[model samples]
Target: MTISESPHEEEPLVASIDVGTTSSRVILFNKLGQEVSKHQIEYSTSASKQKFASGGARRFSVDSAGGGSAGSAGSAGSGAASPSAARQAQQPIFSAEGIAIEANEFLEIEDLERPTNPTLTFPRPGWVECDPVAILAHVVQCFAANLITMDKINGDRVSRSLLPYRVRCVGIANMRETTLVWSKATGKPIVDYGIVWNDTRTTGIVTEKRNSTPQALQDSLRAKTGLPLYSTYFSCSKLRWLLDNEPAVSEAYEQGDLMFGTVDVWLLYHLTANHAFVSDVTNASRTGFMNLDTLDYDDELLKYWNISRDKINLPKIVSSSQYYGDFTVPQCIKPNLTSVAWTLLTDFCSRSPPVPIQGCLGDQSASLVGQMAFKPGAAKCTYGTGCFLLYNTGTKKLISSHGALTTFGYWFPHLENPEHSQPHFALEGSVAVAGAVVQWLRDNLRLIPKAEDIGPLASRVADSGGVVFVPAFSGLFAPYWDASARATIMGMSQHTTASHLARAAVEGVCFQARAILKAMSSDAAGEGQKDRDFLEEVVDETYEKSPLSVLAVDGGMSKSKEVMQIQADILGPCVKVRTSTTSECTALGAAIAAAMAYEKREDRVLWEDLKDVKKWIRYGGVEQGAKSQDGSAPSKSCTYKSQSLDTDRRRKWRLWEAAIDRCKGWMDIVEEGTGAASNSAVKSM
Candidate 1:
């Protein structure tokens, strides 16, 4: 039941399943902190109409958003509608800001818009989604496949021959902030089929609340609610949208029968056969419905949305790694059983004493843990579809000034006792596009034959040749929250090639990340010295207990050595760029949480210290790289000096700033043209 004591004796198996926006994976880790066995299964997103053709020629869509037609899901214009209403539509087609497009010209983006292989479809203009059924089916498939894969890998022959190599506990790390409310009575999702994270349908509800509520009162609500009242991305807006749109949900709220929670809560509910309706603190932090001070649901938030208590099924706020419920396969996957799986499940079920749930943090939180940025100011940037950075702020409630969010850090195992400060806080900033930009190149531009080729190709030239690409494929997010900006590639000339575009794409991502870091520093109340102070503080505390000197990087995209070095060159002055040995930082974070929870520790030491990393670098006096006037690379790129490089990057940022401004008004033009076309439709009728 427990991890074996011997060094070579395999640790008790702990399963970490990552349910990401793009795919699902289950990894089984051994005692040495390495993967023992694993299985990954990819699922498809809803097709877009614009890319679909009956002809066999299979031409890829060049649209920034996914497949759909010009007016379909992946449309270029940001649609107009209330925030709450638009949030539910699931399109990532907003403008430069994180806000949703207006309803009149909905940008129909496909969920899966890669270049190599693509699916095409266009539903009605307003319909966007990830069919709940497909999600459920995928989870089931991953679970079953992982178990089956484990059985095949550790069959009877291996079990008898090598007892050290077996699997043990199972835990899930999921995409937080994505919520769905469904009925418990019928065991079905209550809302429309395609409620995806990027949908911004609930803008109106959020705006109404902001406009109606007094400023002081609203601020109090945010402080009490422990969440911002900005857009429809959070749970409050989604809840409001359901009440406004769906009569059944509205009635359930009235009758006290509406149940809602994020993806993890829903999955656990079904996984445990309704025995567990608990959400770990980290996931709950994202709902904007939880009281930051109390770590409990805010009654006032529910009241503001006019949702009655009895009708909604809510998850209990609990520590990340505690016994949520016993693992029992859902009824649907039960029949297709194997003996090894049966044995494994039976072993897990028979615990005479209840096994404590060891660790539970949101996927982002887990990545923070996995990166070992334990100390205050130590940070990590996770490059997925988007880039999210979390700066551990110890226990302080550092409010954001530059659009960064203040969120609960990981709730350590020891914090479960009432006497402890259960949740730590962090200054968080999220950029909506990162690796997705590379994906855009692969899927949208058809510039790269394979995604992995981007790094080397980008590194071929020292700079991006004055090309600056804002992967505002969806509107911008964090620091500069412009909702109406479209993806724009500026500074292009006759000689500009796809290689320049590729390099610019990477730099654009780094620039966005820099923006997040800048905002987080300002939020921490470290005004003028925010950037430098953060670096120095992190480096000093983490490395030699001196000023901070470098940044630790991880995630799938970190595999690009050129990108990491470029990041280092840009950051300069002991800015160490370190990547993890394993690409599964998120998974590692989950395991660490599970381990800490099992051991009942206050905090587990991080994997890498910023101070220690500072010592490893040999160059201290080198000049940092300079940014050209066009936001392209300078002739000599890798020079690392604090004074020279900092000045130019700041100057280059102005170009980035101006480019954002130039692209901001594009949506109106698209909308007007579309409006005329729509009038023609009416006139024809």
Candidate 2:
């Protein structure tokens, strides 16, 4: 049966909570994909020494290698005998002492401009961590703030007697592979800090596993997990590290009180009042333990890690767009601190019932859904702290011959039969450092006061002035999964200025995205499907005419027209970069998944009605000079057609490529020496 043409319906408003790597947000969207209200809280990673009540002080030391400190926090200590040593002595260590749990209202999205939230603390090189409980508290706070904002907006339209808009469902989109282990009974974190996705401390764990396992076994693992054996990007390696290094974690596991989860599961568990402990297929795909084919934890992979399934609590895998559980307001939010929004939300829930969390997706997959890139070969690039380039491969799970990960895109249970749903798949290329380079520029180099100043500073220079910044700070991901790679700025001359460095940093992000796109295209070509002809057509149209294959972009960095234009240029004339008019596409995607599931639940006829591939053609109406709802199309995106001749682009890309090569093998070379200077050089690079 066909569904109605109107985008709006009686379906209630849906909310999405996006727990990102660098920040957390709660956004509410209507049926037509318009955001009603949003609240955001920014946070960062840290590498500080900690003293536990049970365990004594644990020191995290980074042997200073040389030139300067490696991270943004250490850039000021450049003149010291050893930058790492100097910074280490001055760095504030977060102790388990005097830690208090308090609920801070999530600020409106506009408040994000006030000042940068100091989230990440780099106490030592290659160590990135966050307080998991603090992160969860921020998520709750954002939801409360969003509800308050909604009430303020609704109160203006409706009488005080009437209730504000009700949230019928919630969808969660979270940063994947950031591992956390908490107690199943008490819900307290076993470890004080969460090992962030970009943390490379587990490189030794990955190396040990790879070395211990036979070549054939490693090959089998790659075949099963659809990931290479080198990098520490997955959860299993992080979990392994925790199991070996943290006595608390090991003891908890032995006592059978340990529960493991990626960020999504942690959020879901808290939101549902510890009743629902589950993960969606999209989040499960990145764990490095799930079998790509079976969509379940692989026995052999678990055996390799020496972790028994019964020993620890693992989240149950569920469909991405199905009702998981209901949300319960935590006791921490006292009425005295509650805003009108919270009161309105609680009143609505009391009158009706708690809304179900109907959908969930890993952040990158949700971005793809947000862009409506449902067709095979359709792609997107999200520029957050790191860049994630995802190409939808539709129903087929084409394993990447290249380094890209084969991941579950999304899964919505069939309305009539929940057991028979097929999951969509995508090819993902993760760039370890994207917008984080800008953070380094602002915090470490003191080049710009804010990240937004990057574009203006970069625009002051016509080009990078031969400078190329390869931001492999935590090492390169995808295609080249080198954990030992370090950040490098090459081609600098006496003429180089801050402007040149800023421009180079932006270009570095763009160039890396281009490399991933190239790899994605190559992988798509290798698929040997009918979609190849469509891809060929898109490529042909891009070069011959103005319409290139469109790349729907989102995230903080996508706001920079200069960066987006650079992305278009580096991707060649065949690729058109399109940024969402609304910055909340990631949240909106999660909302869309929830809304779709809600509609399906209400009417089976509407379940897959929107699945028609043609519907996505309207995505980014800015393409081909298409006018938006208003007479003139809004400057939603600043599409920069390839202005440089092919030769010039190639020559520039080659220089950048050379810089990447130079950045490699530095980690290996430094590890051979035990000197503080060598350690400092590695950290400072």
Candidate 3:
């Protein structure tokens, strides 16, 4: 079955709430993991651009590293400004230096500290933020909207069935590392807006931690937690930044009224009426304070960050697929939660029981699960506002030798032991900008009317014509891990045209993804050889074959046939690409977790084994010259079969590599008010 096709028959459904960078969406899935119904609500818009400015989509692709998307180029930071103000704020200059904006020129920020509505604002260069209130409101609105959508689609299946009872369970997947805090008593946001995952505002904090601490301690930070201290990309630093910068938050912390969490904790608190104060293992792992081995907040690590215990309320860590709790219908609705909308959600739930939101995952990890990468060797990439490639290492906790990160893939404690119920670890490589680069072409450069126009625009020219664009916009993630690098467009000549520039930008994303895949493969090979000295049977996954052998893909930008084809050609080697044509794998993964929770609660088995999940999901792949286990033709899918030669791939890589050298170290970024960057051994790539 296709994404547009859904069965209206009597079938139980699970729901997933996807909180991305640009929008919040809800999707209902049957047991087959096919979308039954869904609804999406985009967050806010940014200021318009001049003829040579940037994208109007208001994307914030920071080093904040959203769980799934481009910072998730998402977040509910939707604020519409005056036309004049929008035009005035943008000061686009084509300088001899290749940067889009001068460092001083980007200081024309508006009063985006607080917003009454859904508004996305950029307070500084390389920073993206959203109003916390708007974040919750949009999420609830998506849920409410999905309720209406399901009823209309379900038809006779629902005989006056209240929304709470329409679905058995729900799951939530959101951008990772996007930090939020609120008053525990009033349930109101603490800061003016929540710090988006990609916001690099906390870069100063990262520099301080790495510099002040002894070299030995700095080295062990990654040993204890499979993450490197790159920039302000996690929750702990953002929380600390708030405590120091926002006096109100510091006062609240002292007064014992502060509650800090990622987007997951914020949503769970509101959804369950502030009852479910829990963060799943996946979300908790993203916070720098969480110990990767213990899967809980570490006191020493917290002390390193100066996070006091028994002062602020942190969410209790839980399994990714456990029954956290059931949602509670709020008795009173605020302006954010309207009476009519709440009424649309449930009166039946208020009278009886609310729907159980049992599954939770970070966006990228959820995409892995949604793609059914249950095996350790499997991997998937999400080409959202930011692109993330997560390689499943099963129970093996293989850390990246390259700049890539090691993280908890997913933890399904509800599943039987036969499926290996421990938390899965992964090696992750992230490109801070993907689709946002395209948005730059649309809203800023005005090269095209829509984001999709890049495909046709690129096809206008046979190739990039030797032009190369390296978008190190938010520094670089994954193997390079360079934080000082700014964007650079190299190789442009007198012969270059708009089509050449457009195609080069598209190729930039593909090349970045390729770099990550190569790094992941290198790491996997090293781990396989090293771990064999201590362990056995660890060679079955990526170590046994090539890393990223079968990359399951999803996200907003993955829909482009041109983009996928470019990715295949650049990949060069023989690889099978399974594109999630539905582009909702992140939501599907969350729903699957919810389904697992529901099944465990009812003592029923959804699949004979967890490995069979991909088959039930509405996925059919088209493989060229490939046969099934039973020697039958492979299932049909929107897959790309590449005839890319090694020489061509190398040439593209060399072009990108040259541009990267020119772009790196363009900015000497330092955290404000804490210390100078000179004191630290920070690599500002």
Output the number of the TM-score-best candidate. 3
In terms of lDDT, the poorest run of 10 residues in model 2 is 61-70
Model 3 Cα lDDT, one tens digit per residue, 145-261: 556556556564455563222576779999899888889988788777888888888877887777788878876888777888656677888888889999999999999999999
Candidate 1: segments with Cα more than 4 A from true spot = 1-10, 48-128, 155-161, 192-194, 208-214, 225-227, 335-358, 415-421, 525-548, 599-644, 665-685
* Best candidate according to lDDT: 3
For each candidate, the alpha-carbon lDDT, in order, equals: 0.59, 0.68, 0.68
Candidate 3 lDDT at 199 equals 86
Candidate 2 similarity to native, TM-score:
0.81
Q: What is the lDDT of candidate 3?
A: 0.68
Error of 1 at 61 (Å): 9.1
Q: Count the clashes in each prediction.
A: 90, 16, 31
TM-score: the better of candidates 2 and 3: 3
Candidate 3 Cα outliers beyond 4 Å, as residue runs: 1-10, 46-115, 158-165, 331-340, 351-353, 528-545, 598-609, 619-636, 669-685
Q: Rank the candidates by lDDT, best first.
A: 3, 2, 1
lDDT of 1 by residue, 293-366 (tens): 88888788778777666667788998776556656556554333344444544554555443333456788887
Q: Write the per-residue lDDT of candidate 2 for residues 500-522, one digit (tens) a residue.
A: 99999989888888877777777
Worst 10 residues of 1 by lDDT: 69-78
Prediction 1 global C-alpha lDDT: 0.59
